[model samples]
Target chain A: MLSGKKRGLQSIEFLQAPIISSSASVAGPLESKSSWAEDFDWIMEDYLLGESSWERTETKVLQQVIQIALDKQQLSFEDIEVFLAGDLLDQIISSNYTARELKTPFLGLYGACSTMAEAILIGAMLVEGGFFTRLVAAAGSHHYTAERQFRFPTEQGVQPAPYSQWTATAAGALVLEAQGNGPRVSSITIGRIVDMNQKDANNLGAAMAPAAADTIHRHFLDLNRDSDYYDLVVTGDLGLVGQDLLEELFVQQGVVPKPNISDCGVLLYDGIPEVNAGGSGCGCSACMLCGPLLKKMYRGDLQRLLFVATGALMSPTSTNQGESIPGIAHAVAIEI
Target chain B: MTPDSNEERKKIEEQEYQQLVEQVRPRPNILLNCIWAFIIGGLICTLGQLILDYFRAQGMSMEDAGAMTAVSMIFLGALLTGLGWYDELGKKAGAGSIIPITGFANAIVASAMEYKREGYIFGVGARIFSIAGPTLLFGFVAAVIIGLVKYLTMLW
Candidate 1:
């Protein structure tokens, strides 16, 4: 039989397993809901850093945010037990280059845009499992860098379709510790990878909506919790189209939550124009996770939240092989 | 003997100067050069558009086609450079010929061709890798290091 103190400690340990103490994002004014554009030309001229590549921009932003966390917490890079990150770059350029500037051990992760939640869940598990006490999970995306690698350079004058997602140029970082009496990560529901065989890249919202709905539905079922329990449920970067489709899909499945469900892609580019649909990139959710959401959490504006970062796992090689893009979503629930 | 030598040297100097002037005279027509540059640049972009259309017709995704366009431009530039056509085009258009995607392709091919004459092991092979080698190296190294840091930071 365990002593009352031991039992209480064990319960606390489980409750505080993976706590997200803080977060931040580096985005342009458009990403912060200050502007909006219906076409890509406006974005090319007004939103982008015409001089620097994505790698440089992403690294600079990520370094700045990490520096803030380090300074605020008075924690040294060497003291961070683990650094987990992901990005859309083939080799995860932002995380890699940024890591070169830091002293912490790194873990390169790639789950497309769903990387933040994935990293958070993994970091939480490590902390809970007593593998490490302090873990930092960060992710970033640069419009130019992602464009050059996955699309075309801005100088090319390529017109983006309406359904196309504007790659959000930003980075997000979260520092997780085992000691805090903060809200603990109550449950994490890993998503099933869903491939809908949709070839139209422009219609990524439609391609990814089913997966988002599927994951959220399954997650709620697994935890035996209603959607109303959480104040907000956020999905990575599904944009306007995916959000609508997700709502409709949920209705069809007989699970209708309040309109409190939001998408990072849609919210990140609220006022920003020229981005016809909205922000979608590896950093879309990464920045959101670190920015407004973290600020709200710290302010006690949110008590329980579910962050589901989604990724469209489509590669040049896979597309070349005539394979349709498969989608993945990972959900991490945090309660304070 | 001194007077004759002086006269002979002056004649030689004047003749050499005139010959140099003749050698420096403009040969290529400026208008023709501009025309070729415009035509070549337009043609390259047209080809790129055609390729993009073809890819899209084949049901390739827009993002995929966008990426393919860049690759296609690089290859087209290399082919033109190898055939000595790009040099002629460059001579005519100046920066106009070099500003587009084809220009990067030409640079890579030209660099490789220039070094290939040196030898296979030390010249061609090594030099071919030199042009984009740094970009590849830096990109890869940066990614690996970031991965390592992320791994280490996650460890307790």
Candidate 2:
């Protein structure tokens, strides 16, 4: 089991199990009143955060969040060897601009809302492979920026369909070191693109649900574990609608993940009806994992967690071109 | 389960999954939305008529009063859009708010306000007509064809 080879179909067992030293989560004002607000490190008073543009505020949040994590452990930029960060922007602008400020060796990733998990899994692999002793995995998203980029402008008067998700204006950063005293990255399942020709952008949960189910199913298959293996299996940004679809998928596959299975998107809102379906974007799960979930782990309330971040990989251009939305989900298992 | 080896089976499976999704997904109540649209839209039209009547009572000609009512309605729509209330209205009113001339004004002002940050020339100027452009294009085409038919009928 400790062999440095691929374990199953699409999973990798990190022999070294890179440790998470410290983490920080920051969200916009919209999330300040959320159920888990107290768990967050900080919440901005406004989406702009006094910046002229939403993009700038997103970059500032990403940069400041990484610093916040490092500050918690008395670490500095010189202590980090690599930075893996991403955002939901045209070119991952927030991460790129933040990287330029930090001047750290960087890798910019784009997995849409799955960015946080994608970055974490890759960072864990690199640390276990002895590539670097220290790396930072971070991701963030802004509601306003995502609005103009994906849908219409923030102020544009288009009524959101009942199935539409509220893109979270949030970010999270975690410090991953080869050795530390915290939860360890035990294993990961890299997802595949699962597209059922679902073309409705307003219903991202539907488009992304299949990919989440596929990744989660394969994770269990590779680990040869039951639904009760992990203390909890939480999917990223699969709001209420996606959660229901996933339930059906589980029933079909003879998997009863009830009571243990949950969704970050649905939990983030905590019955905030105006959010339509629920919270989404990369930050939806990032903050959940870095904030409340991690606190639960530290408190020994949880022993094992499977964080499967789902993403609908479709751009406005692709939608206009009549292409279906393809979805992907990456799973990272953390054990304390 | 492993990826199905049979292509036909995979297609059928995908279809089944979508069907399952449909069963679970929530739908907007069509009847409720229609009712709200009817009420809100009717109120907006009634407001316009009230304005026309007020102008006509001032001894203004019928044509002048009608033109003033159109201007007043557009002004109100644009102001509401700027104040961000029009969109809130739009959420409930749906096609009821959209079928009138005020809806046309809302469409244009909304685009301009949204694109203001991108700049004047390329942003507001180029994109101002984005939402209402199609309506104007179709209106012109229909008008030209109808006028041509009327002229030919008169000659006949």
Candidate 3:
């Protein structure tokens, strides 16, 4: 009864089965110091990466990661149908500049931190629907670039509050092809903008928790499957607070998530005194999924996993004007 | 559930969520942070004084030497900020690194460097004063008020 093209209200069951051809993850110096340091293909010597500005450095990372992904697949930009990417900067300058250099047809996206999943979802759909043969999905965020744009300057010498999550300086690029030997993208659940009237920018975890849980619950229901169906269920950079909130919300809704659920923000860093809550930004889940998670799937450790990338959709102007933060989380079921 | 009850439930859930977050949030060691701040702040001030003394010994007036010292300290702070070293210093010293003129310089340079990608005119020029804007605004207003008060006192 539940085996159809459309799932309930939000999810789409991919019958054509788009495959991930290859992926490359690149991280900055601070992210390299994380627990999964060795996972990244290339770790820059510094945040700037010998670039003049943080934004440019982020663009450089995107370019490098895209090239790496393309190289890994033994494909070039001409082979890819289109490149989809986004970042934390205003108008997504990082992805835009990288697009200019890539010379590939590009569609810029903005889902805050959830851009990764959003891109993957759209790319997979395009590939599965026979609209495109090879598509590249990329996203990134720089700590310095995001800090100045969203909160404060990195060098302001301002001590971050406890609830504040450290913005990750990294980028990830994934090449999704119509047919490949890589993991199959089976389903995608698009998230709705969920606002719980929470406005604290420093506490993004709480603001994003409800949206993540809403999407996860919807995904499972739409697919007519239980939590035990997936090998793992992961959320984008919700850190420790959002992880706890997600678990609580699921319990309240009588929806039991898989026991292997983990937050990329919590997994990246090891309870460091510097990063108050944990690692965050568009790059957090992007790098983790492209690197360690993909490797695990390739090694047959994880067969079916739900990758949910969550985002806090808030702007400086909206925040200053006392607007509540709207959060979104898109889920893509990846199977090998 | 009714729509009103759903709203009520959401409010209760929000409150409970806030409480959970607060419960797990880490509390900073205030005493230790204060101690580090005091020591580092005092050392920085001492360094400023030594620079002022050196300038005074080089035959500059005390006022001029004081001004030069402020300028030099601001430059040092901005330099360290550009090099991305001041943040590391801030990690250990806390507010000690920020409660000085150097902190003000760091704020301006950091903003300028951050927004430089947007373009020089709109980015650097506009956001250069983002952090220091309030301080400078109030400082100028206070100066105007003090000048008016001094003039009134003299007339009296």
Best candidate, TM-score-wise? 2
lDDT of each: 0.71, 0.88, 0.88
**Which window of 10 residues has the lowest lDDT sum in candidate 2 chain B?**
B1-10
Error of 2 at B87 (Å): 2.2
Select the stronger candidate by lDDT from 1 and 2.
2
- Between prediction 1 and prediction 3, the one with superior DockQ is 3
The positional error of residue A13 in candidate 3, measured at the CA in angstroms, is 1.5
In candidate 1, stretches whose alpha carbon ends up further than 4 angstroms from where it belongs are A1-14, A32-53, A181-183, A257-259, B1-156
What share of the reference contacts is kept in model 2? Answer: 0.53
- List, residue by residue over B60-96, the lDDT tens digit for candidate 3: 9989999999999999999999999888788778889
Q: What is the Å distance of residue A147 in model 3 from its true position? A: 2.1
TM-score of candidate 3's chain B against its reference?
A: 0.84
Q: What does candidate 2's lDDT look like per residue over A1-336, in tens digits? A: 556557779999887899999999997787777888899999898878788788889999988889899999999998889999888999899999999998889999999989999999999989999989999999999998898888875555566788889999889999999997899999999999999878889888999999998899998888777777898899988899999998877888777655378999988888566788988998888988998898888888999999999999999899989898999999999999
lDDT of 3 by residue, A233-314 (tens): 9899898878888887777888864446898888877656568787899998899999888988988999998999999999
